[model samples]
Structure formats: C-alpha cells, structure tokens
Target chain A: MKRAAAILGIGTDHVYEVDPDESGRVSAEKMEEKILYCQELGFSVFFVGITAGTTVYGAFDPIEDIAIICRKYKIWLHVDGAWGGSALLSPKTKHLLQGIDKADSFTWNPHKLMSIHLQCSAILIRHTNILMQANQMCAGYLFQPDKHYETSLDTGDKTIQCGRHIDILKLWLGWKARGHQGYAEHIETLLEKANFFYEIISKREPCFRMVIKPPFINVCFWYVPPSLQNIDQTSLEYNERLDKIAPRIKERMMTNGTMMVGYQRLDHHPNFFRAIISNPATTKDDIIAMIDEIHELGHDL
Target chain B: MKRAAAILGIGTDHVYEVDPDESGRVSAEKMEEKILYCQELGFSVFFVGITAGTTVYGAFDPIEDIAIICRKYKIWLHVDGAWGGSALLSPKTKHLLQGIDKADSFTWNPHKLMSIHLQCSAILIRHTNILMQANQMCAGYLFQPDKHYETSLDTGDKTIQCGRHIDILKLWLGWKARGHQGYAEHIETLLEKANFFYEIISKREPCFRMVIKPPFINVCFWYVPPSLQNIDQTSLEYNERLDKIAPRIKERMMTNGTMMVGYQRLDHHPNFFRAIISNPATTKDDIIAMIDEIHELGHDL
Candidate 1:
C-alpha cells in the first residue's frame, strides 16, 4: 500500500488512491468518494487498504462494500488478504472474504494461495494490546521488565524484529498437512484451474484473447500471433504486434526449458498473460501445456 | 536507530540523543558537539548513526572520529555493523572498523559474527544506484519494459519485496564452507573466548565485577553473590543489592538449563551480566563453566 504509506511517514501528498472498478475491484463507490473527498479537504482519514487479492488482477475488493464505508468512517479497516487469502480455504471461495469479519487488520499470505514455502506471512490483529501498542521496543537488553518468566511472555518485545526467523514453521506445517478439508481440496483445485484457463482462453478466438475474465486465479491472456492474426484489434499495429508477443513468448519460454508465463502492461492492457493459478500441482496437462506452449512460441511473432 | 527515525517520518521531536561515553562508546566529542548543536538550531543534519557494534556495550563507535564529523557535516554516514561487523573477519579485529570505508551505509549481520544461519543480514551499499534510488517499484506486472532478459536484470525492481526468500543460500554455504582463512579462524576463536571470559571475570574480584573492560565480544560482569560480599560498594544498598543479582542469576540460568547471559539496566549499570560471546562453540571449558555456573546460580542472591 505504497509501502505502507511509505512506512507510515505517509507522504505522496497524504496518499489517497481509490479508483479500481472495471472488475480489477476496489471501487467501493470510489472508496466512499475518496473518503468523502478526504473529509472535504480537511483530511484525517487514516486507514482503508482493502485489496483482497489483486496483484495483476486476481481482483476481489468489494469487501462487503468496503465494510460499510469502513463502519461509517471510524476508518482503520485494512484487509489486504495477500493473494485472495487462499479464498479462505474455500467454502466455495468464502464469499470472497465478505467483510473479512469486519477487518481491523488482516494481511494473510500463507505464501500466496497456501503453497506456503517462501516466507509465509500473517499479520491478523483484530485487537488485543494493539500489536503491543504499535510495537513496543522495551529493549533494556532484550525486554527485561525484570523477567522471572511472564515478562508478558516475551514476544521479543512485540517485534519490529530483533531477530525473528522461525516464520511459522512452514505455515504450521502447511496447516498440519492440509487439514481444513485439505485446504478445501486445495482451494477447489486452484479454482478449477482458473476456471479451466478461463474456459479455454475464452473459447479460443483469434488464437486466444481474454484479459478480464479472470476473477481470482489471475488468468489474463493474449497469445494472438498468427502474424498478428488479421490485425486491427483496436490497432496501433494491433498493440504494436500485441506488445511484441509477451516478450517474444517469454523469450521462448526461457529458451525452451518449458512453458512460463507472467507478461505485463496492466490497465488499458497490452502485454498480457499473467496465469497465476498458484500450483496445486498444476496439471490439466499443465494447463494444456500452457496453451500449447504459447501457440508454439508465439506462432511466428 | 529509533526505528530508522520512525520510518523516516523522523519525529520523536526530531530525535536528538548524543550521550554514550563512559566506555559505551559514541562520543566523538559528543558527536561533534551534537552536530554543531544541531547546526545552531537550524537543524538540517540528515544522518550520522555510527555504532559499529554496541548492542549492550560491545561498543566501537569512534569510526575514525565519526568519519571526520560525517565529512564535516555533509552528513549521511551510517554504520551499525551489527555486532562489530564480525570485526571484519579478524585481521586482529580489523582496527575496529577503522573509517569503515568512509561509510554511506554498512549494516552487516552475518547472523551476528558469521555463524550465518538465522536470516543472515547484509546492507553494505557505498553508492551504486543508491539501493536503486531507495527502492524502486517499476511494477508494471513486475518490471517488464519489454523483457527479453536484461529488463535491467530485474532484481524484482530493487525490492521492498514481492516474494523474496532465497536468503543467500545459508550465507553462501557459510561462505563456501568457511573459506577466507576459515572465517579468520572462526573470528579468532570468538575473540579468544571473549578474552577468556575477560580474564576469569577480572581475576575474580570480591567474587567478580568487571563491567567495562570489554570492547568487543561483550563480556560484561558482576556475579558478586556470597550474600552480597560485604556490601558498601557504592551504596544505594549496593546498587539495590547489585540489582537483584542479575535477575536472580537470570532466573537460575533459566531454571538450570545451564547458562545464558543478557541482563540489562544499562546506563546507570545495575543488573549487569551481558556476556554475548557469539558462540564459537564457547569452550574454554565453556568459559570456566560460565564462572562455575554464575557462582553456583548466584550463591544466595
């Protein structure tokens, strides 16, 4: 969130972003009209955040209409849910985190879609000592408020980190070997392989197109290159030959070691292919061999 | 550093602090007389930092006389050197970080003295693209300015982190299985077991005392028990009975699971025992069995 409002010093002219609706979510009525136009320019609106998933359009923002305008301006809301919070272990996508139990803070990143390995994340909060009153240092050589056991159970002085690594033991051993019904059948099989690759690349037209069909597992697309497939799809030479075909089919899928994805230019979209169905062991023949290896390496890009 | 000046918002009333000297370093003439008295109250002194080691007085700070008053006030020096930058891999404690290569950032953790395991730290800096102009985020779906390799070698757009963890392969396999003269003989055998536990607790003063002789591996002391060794040391009932004998000998060395050391009350030095030798497998008979286990777990507090 602009690096947590630039580490809370909060500057970019007191940061007030808002805009996101054509399905890349967040427009809770333009975030209540930009918090009533930054409280009519007097400005005190402290917190809102809201993005339930959204890194390259795994979009989920409404959050019960931004928690009813952050509980009518008592502000603080937060959410984030890092990568759709593994759709809250999917009771069929947990109502896309409805109001996230009226979030006072959420964050959740069980390392994106609960695969868990790389730096699993958390945050959570809700209330209790407010993260020990916003991170208590208490550092008299490591939190010794005369420690004979319960020095408030030394959470290392409620951390801004003075040595922290056990990062929740592989997210508590991947939630104890995937319990909650094996993480809701691995988040309903990665949302059914992102709705089966957005229903076969929106029924394969002009060699694949759909950029907005992905509501969660970030499918985004754009293979297109039968030599720009009869150009002029709102051409500027058909988006400069579809922005040089996803970095030349991602440099031939990293020099043909196999398929890869992630391309870019987001809003007013140009370079596409995001494909982030967070690996619940991928197969449907690896999403049809990533669309037949991006149409056999961009079909003569 | 007051949490990087409260994450750069910089306000504990624009943080002043200077003091340290009674052997707990940092008084380059009271830090250039508090940066010429905060520039005669017009205060524009950006950075100074300096430490070199100092987490509980393993003090070093005179970094070549604070790098000549941060180059005569063109400020920005920084040094920290988390635990004496492992005394620069010990060429006899590399002149306690001399001018630390005229520092413009240093940090260095090597997991405190190069044992390098839990989150091995780094920082270093000295100029090049200033950590990509203080952290870049050219995030158009992850820095793809037409990426066919060399999208400015995308270091995830110079990191605030969008998925990070390859935490330097166990500090590069413990510096490739201890090269560099086997990490200077494991940092000169943990500075010779902290000068052999500060020469047997300063030759066992009236049952041990030496709190300030340590300049590096942080020995610090006090154990004085035998029912407070005929008191009257500098009475306030002898520093409140030597501050309740190092937290009752650190709560009987954590209920007798052998020894640990970190006690606190620094400035007026009350609860003493800091110890911190950063384990080079301790043994000088585990520093004389940690002074016969802190005089047998503090002989009658």
Candidate 2:
C-alpha cells in the first residue's frame, strides 16, 4: 500500500498509519480521529484502507465502523482481505466481516486461506465502470470494432496489463471441486485447530507465553527457553537475547527439515513466533510436534 | 509507457512522439530534433524509447546512431525489442542490433520469437545497482538479516511484486534443452521462411501487394482480389473496398478453419495481412497452402 501510494507521488509523510489495539485490530475511534485530523488540515481524504486480516496477526478490523466513517467522508474504502477474506464463506465466522458489502473495493487472495494455487487473486470494485474508466487503453490493433461477437466482452482494455496469465481457471476449478460448504468446513476446522493450539500453549505456562488470545487462525506466542523464562521481558538484555532465539531455532528447523513457523518483532515488542493454521490437513499432533521441536532446538540457548 | 508516465504525474502534453520514416523505423535525425525541441522547452530529457522491431512492418531502428545521441545528451536509451530481441542469437541478423550493448536498458519477451511459453519477459539494465536502489523495500518480515543463506540472493526485495510465479525454471530448462547453437539455427530457419513467403507474395503482383521487404520474420502484404487489381490504391473507394477484403477473408478462414492471419490499417495504408513465420514447423507447402486458401476464399470478392 505504501509502495502504491509512493508510485502515485504521495510522500511517506502524507501516509498516516492508524495503530492497532493490543489484540492487533485497528481501533474504530483511532481511524475516525485520523480522518478528522486530515480534514482539519484541508486534505481531501481520497482512500481509507482497512486490513481485513493483517499478515503478522490474522486480526480482522471492525469493518462496520470503518464503512460508516468512509460513507460520512465520501472516501473510497478498500478492504485488504488478502489473507482472511475466505472466512466470509463460513457461516459461523461470516459475522466478523459483516459490513464488507459497504466497501468501495476489496482485494481477496484465494491462494492463502483457501489453499488454492499461488498467484490467484481478485480485486473487486463496487463500481466496475470506474475501474474501466481508470484502466481502458483503446489500443486500435487489439480491441477491434469489427469483431463478430460483442466487443464489450473483450476484457483487454479493463486491466493495466495487456496479456495476463490464465490463473482464474485453476481457482474456478478448485472451487467447483470443493463446493462453498466444503470451504466453510475447512475454515471452521482451521480456526478450531488454532484455538486448540492456544489452549495447549496457555497450559504450558513459562515454556510458552501467549502474545494475545487467538483471534483468527493465527496464534502468536513466544517459546520461552529455560534461560529467559524467569527474566524480565522489558529488560534490554532479555529482549536482545529473545530476538536471537527465533532465528536460531529457524536455522535448526531448516537443517533438520522439521516443522516451519514465522517470527517477527512488531514495534516495541520482542521477537515472537506467529503460527498460522491455514491448512485444514494440519492435525493437533502436528501443532504439538512444532512446540516440541522448538523446545528441543532452542533448549540450550 | 504513457500510462506509467501519467501515473508518475507526467501529462500527455509532456510526451512528444517522433514519427517513423517510410520504412517504419524512427530516423536518427527526427529523434535528435525532438530531443533538442524538448530541451529548448526546458524539459529534462529522461528517456528515449526505440522500437527495435515495429509490429506492422518488422523494421530495425538504427540503434548505433540512437545510442550515440543518447550518450551525448546523457539520457537513458531503452530499446523495446519485445518482438525482435531473439534475433540477437542469429549470426546473420545480429548486426541489425549492433549497438544493443550500449543501451541503458532493453526489454525482451521470450514468448515472442523464442517460442517459450507466454508471460516470459525480461528487462535487462546496464546498471544492476540502480535497479536494486530503485526497487528495494526494507520489509522487516521478509528480508531478514539473520537468514542462513546469503540474504542478497533473495530477489523479493528487488521487484515490485511481492508474490511472483516461478517462471524462471521454464525459461532456464527450455534454454538448456535447446542450446545457443540450436536457437541460432531456429531463428535462421524462421527468417528463411519469411523471405520465402515474401518472394512468393511478390510474384503474385497486384493480387498480393508487398508491404515493404520484411526486415524480420513478419511477411506483410495485401491479398487483393482480381476486381480491385486495376483500381488506384490512393483512391478513397479503392481503400474502402480494400479494407473489407481482409476481414471478409478472415471470417471465411475462421468458419472453414483453413488458415488464420492478422490484418490492420497502419498509418494511411489500407488494411493488409501480416503473416509471421515464428513456428519452426512451417514449410513451403504450408505457405503455398495459405496463398491458395486466400485465393479460394476471396477470389470472387
């Protein structure tokens, strides 16, 4: 999003990031405040983007409140649901994204949660005519008027690209094979696994420290080694040592071909692991094995 | 390229296009005149793009002269060799791109003449460091410093795309299967077929008007019927009648599944067919069959 804005001549200073709460979800009040501040400065609020599911933590932003603000300001609301948009298919969790229809535009990558092949993503706009107006390049040679069929169906002018890979076929076929009900069941199962992992990690006490309650399918926690279990986390030495643990464990995991997990330090927080359960095939045993493997690899450190 | 410049806040009025010569290649003098004019208007001449092989007529721009002008003005010279870059492998035609080594950047599509699968294109830059400097985004989560392997090998930082398809393997394996010598032979064969087709069309006189001697593997000619042979080509009625022939023949070809050819009206020229011989399997018999099929389909018209 920053790169896109930068490309359009928007400086980094103009891009204001509204911070997320303790649960990693952006606050509705904070967003409204930012919008009001921008208006006060006589700036036209053109775009307001809400991350439906953040990459580090699979937390959904409060879409209902964001949509209301967008409507009031007449700003284009874009929902970046690249990671968690598939959850809308699940009847149980669809309420998480209740006001998704109000968004002016939304981006959803089927490859992530749906487990479809990579490079399958859709950017849907509520006003498709606006999209055409922005992208149409009437190249005379390709989009010919003398075609036998309807020329409106020639989608070449509707995209920034002249030639695009046929990635939609794979996504369409995969969706057909696994019906809507199948996807809902898969999403529900993955969330259940995440909750199950969270419970186990909580019971393990000092060995594993839960960063936050499992919001979506992402369970972020720090695998506290025996040496740092008793130390104050806010201490400089403790954080310095904690930062090195995930990288070292990741190195060992790669060498042994064991379980794989991602780790990153957000803001002032120390390095912590982010375990995502997107694959429905991932069993409870697999989650348990990951915890055991991390312990075994980083016990000495 | 215009759209990209527009996005970067450069208006259409700022863009100046120098017309190509009668041979469809941009003349060096015309290019220099445009550059001097832009400079006179107090515009910073940033880029000058030369089409190595024009789509309508496969004409090679005088790269040697253009490169010298670019050097003199300290401007970036980008060669759009998307259609004809593969000719570099052929010993006979490599001289056409004599000063390609001096170009600041060049775009080549392996999908065109190389017969590699679609979506395989490369932009070769003279300065590798500048590319990295322009594209590098220090994303903390992805480009980690503590990686086991050399992190510099991670190409993710050096591209605009976050997730890219693994297209390199196909190009690499295809290049390996057919070595440099094999490509040279293939290119030479295609050029020979193009010349053969040109000779055949030239013999047919008024029935097939040759659209300049093809510089590359594109054989462009008008498949004029017997009725329009005596008419002056410059006449409005003649051009109007001539424009209808290719489309009518194309419709018949599609319905009969005899042969497929592309047609377009370039500049002030009437509608003409552009037959390309990129396929290695194309034989003299196939070329003869196409000519016979066109006559059979459009003889009465």
Candidate 3:
C-alpha cells in the first residue's frame, strides 16, 4: 500500500496511520478522526485501507462502522484480508468480516490459509470493467481483434503482465476437493486450536504472558523466565530485559531444531512470539511442544 | 520499459523510439540521433534500452556500438534479451550478444528459448547493492535485526514484493540435469532447425515470400495463394488483400486443429506469419507438416 502511494507521488506527510486500540484492532472512531484530519489539511480522503486481519495479533477491524465513514466520505474502501480471509468460510466466524460486502475491493491469498502453495493471491474488485479500463494496453500483436473464441475470456489485456504464472490451477483443484464445508471446518479447527493455546498459556501464569485475547489464529505471547518473574511488569528495565528473551529463545530454537515461531515488537511492546495456527495439520501436541521448547530454551534467562 | 517510464512520470513525448534498419536491427547511429534529439528537448537520457532479439523479425541490435553511446551519455544500458539470452549458451550464436557484459542491466526469460516453464524470468543487474538501496522498506516486524544465520540472504527486502514465488528451484534443477554443454547443444539444435525452415521457405520462392533473413529463430514469411500469385507486390490493393490472407488462414487452422503459428503486421508490411523454432522437440517433419497444413488450409484464400 505504501508502494502504491509512493508510485502515485503521495508524500509522507499526507499518509496518515491511525493507531489501533489496545486489543490491536482499529476502531471506526480513530479512522473517522484520521479522515477528518486529512480533510482539515486540504487532502481528499480517496482511499481507506482497513486491515481485515492484522499481522501481529490477527485482529479484525470494525468494518461495519468503517464502511459508514467511507460511504460518507465517498472513499474507496479496500480490505487487506490476506491472512484472515479464510475465516470467512466458517459460519461461526463469518461475523468477523460482517461488512466485507461493502468494501470496494479486497485482496485475499488462498496460499496462506488454504495451503495451496505460494504466490496464489487474488484481488477482487466490485467493478470488473475498471480493471480493463486501467490496465488494457491493446497491444495489436498479442491481443488481436480476430480470434476464434470470445475475446473477453482472454485475460491477458486485463493484466499488467504479458505472461503470468498458472497459480490458479492448484487452488481451483484444492477448493474442488475440499468443498466449501470442508474449508469451513478446516478454518474452525485451526481457530479452536489457537483458543486452546491461549487457555494453556494463561494457565501457565508467570512462565508465559498472553499479550492479548487473539480474535483469530495469531496468538501473541512472551516467555517469562524465573529470574524476571518477580520484576514489575511496568518497569522500563523489565521490558528491556524481556525484549532480549524472545530473540535468544529463537536463536536456541533454530539451533535445537525443535520448532519455529515468529517473534516481533509491535508499538512500544516488547518482542513477543506471534504463534500462527493457520495450518490445519497443527495439533495440540505441536502447540504444547512449542511452549515446552521455548521454556526449556529460555527458563534460565 | 514503457510501463516503467510511465510509473516514473515520463510523458509519451519524452519516450522516443528509433526504428530498426532494413535488416530489422537498430543501429548505433539511429540510437545516437535519438539520444541527441532527447538532449535537444532538454530531457535527461537516464536509460537506454537495447533489444537483443526483436519480436517480429528476431533481429539483434548492434549492442557494442550502442553501449559506447550509452557510456558517453552516462546512461544506464538495459538489454531486453528475453527471447535471445539462451543463445549465450551456444558457442555459434553467442556472437549475436557480443557486448552483453557491458550492459548495466538485462532481462532474460528462461521460459522462452531455454524452455523451462512459463513465468521464469530474471533481471540481471551489474550492481548488487542498487536493488536493496532502491527497494528496502525497513519493515521492522518482517525483517528483524536479530535472526539466526545470515540475514543478508533474506531477499524479501531487495524485492518490491512481501511474498514471492519460489521460481528459482525448477530453473536450478533443470540447469543441473542438463549441464552447460546440454543447454548449448539444445539452443544450437533449435537455431539449426530455424535455419532449415528459412532455407526451405526461400527455395519455395513465390509460394512463400521470405520477409528478411532472420538473425535468430523467427522466420517471417507470407504464404501467397494461387489467386494473388500474379499480382504486383508493391500495389496497395495487393497488400490489403494479402493482409486478409493470414487471419483467414489462421481461422481455418484453428477450426481444423492441425497446427498453430503466430502472425503480425510490422511497419508498412502486411500481416505475415512468424514461425518460431524455440521448441527443441520440433523435427524437420513438423516444419514440413506446418507448411503443408498452411498450404492446404490457405490455398482457397
């Protein structure tokens, strides 16, 4: 999105980022405030990007309220559902993306949650004609007028590229094999496993600290060693020390080759492990093993 | 290249095109003239794109002289060797890309002449650091400071994309299976086959009017029917009628489902067939069969 803004010659000052709530979800009020702030600065609110599932905590923004603001401002609402879009298949979790139908455009990657290999992403737009209007080059040599079949089916002109990879076949076949119900069940099972992890970490108490109640599959947490158990959580020195634990534990995890989990610092927070449960194959054993491995590696720290 | 220029905010007037010579190759003099014209218009010559193998006639530009002009103007020389880069593997055809080492950057597609698969292309740059310098976002969450092993190997920062397809594995494995010698022989064989087609088409005289002596694998020709056998080649009406022949014949070919060949119109020229011989599996019989099929399908036209 930054790249697109840069390409369009939008300056850094014009690009505003609204901070998310403590739960890592962006409120509609914050979005409206940012829009009004831009309007006050004499900038038109052309595009409003809402993260359907954020990277760190897998938090879903309040799309319904955000949609109302976007409609009022006449802005093109784009949803980045790259990680969390698969949850929409589940009947129980479909409410997470309640106002998704109101979005002007949405980007989803089947490769992530669907496990259909890498580079299988799709950008769906409300108006199909807009794609051709924006991208059609009408290169006479390739896309000729006189062809055997319906020329509209020839997708070459609608794309920016001359040649594209056949990344759709695997996803098509996978979807056919799994069916809609199978996919929903798969997503539901993963979320349930994430909930299990959240419960287990909460019961562990001082040994582990749950960052937030994850709304989706990404569970953010930190491993607290016995040495740091007595330290005040609000202390600057404590967070500085806590920041060192994850990277050290990650280093040991790499060397030991037991399990791998991603760690990152998100806005004033210390480095914490972001455990993703998108893989349907992941069992309770794998989740338990990850925790035990992190404790075993960093308990002395 | 045009798309890149557009993204960089260069207008169509600033983008100049130097026509190829009678032999279908762009000369150094023409390039220098274009560069001088751009300078006179107060435009900086930042990039000089030299086509290694043109689409219509498979012509190779005089790169050695073009490189010298680029050096004098302090312009970055980029060679579009998408079609002809595989010729580098062949000892006999390597002379076609004589001054390739002098180019600042080059685009090569292993999917084309090398016949690996679709969408396997590479952008080769002389300077390694330039890519990272231009593209690095410094996204702390994704590219962390503390990681195991060499962080320099993480190519995500060097690319504009967050997630990229693993396109190198197939190319690597294919290259390993077929060593340098095998690839050289493969390219040599294809070129030899193209030469055989050129010779046959030349011998066939009035039936097949050869466009130009192809420098590479593309053999451009017109399959003249018996109806227009006696007409003047320079007549406007004759060329107009000739233009209709290819599309008509192409329609017949598709309906018959015998073989497929590409046809296109160049500057002031009628639509002529461009028989590409990139397929190593193509035998002399296939070439002979294609001509026979064209004759059989297009005789009435």
Please provide TM-scores, in order, for all candidate models, with all chains considered together. 0.36, 0.96, 0.97
Whose TM-score is higher: candidate 2's or candidate 3's? Answer: 3
lDDT of 2 by residue, A167-253 (tens): 888889988998999988989999899999999899888888888887788888888799998898789988899888888888999
True contacts kept of each: 0.79, 0.37, 0.46
lDDT per residue for candidate 2 within B73-134, as digits (tens), equals 99999998988888898899898898999999999888888888877888899996776687
Quote model 3's TM-score.
0.97
lDDT (CA) per prediction: 0.81, 0.85, 0.87
The top-ranked prediction according to lDDT is: 3
> Which candidate achieves the best TM-score against the true structure?
3
- The per-residue C-alpha lDDT of model 1 at residue B70 equals 84
Better of 1 and 3 by DockQ: 3
Q: Per-residue lDDT tens digits of candidate 1, residues A58-146?
A: 88887888888888889989888877877988788889888788888888888778888878788887888777766674667767787
Off by over 4 Å in 2: none
Q: Please, what are the lDDT tens digits per residue for candidate 3 over residues A1-301?
A: 6655654456445568899989878899999999999899898889999888887889999888999999999999999899888778899898999899999998899999888889899888997688777666676766677676788988887876778888899899999999999999998898899999999999898899999998898899999999999999999989999999999999988888877788999888999999987787888998888788889999999
DockQ of 2: 0.53
- DockQ (CA atoms), all models: 0.28, 0.53, 0.56
TM-score of chain B of each: 0.35, 0.96, 0.97
lDDT of 1 by residue, B138-211 (tens): 66766777766666556665666668777778988888998889998888888888888889887888788887
List pairs with backbone clashes in candidate 3. Answer: none
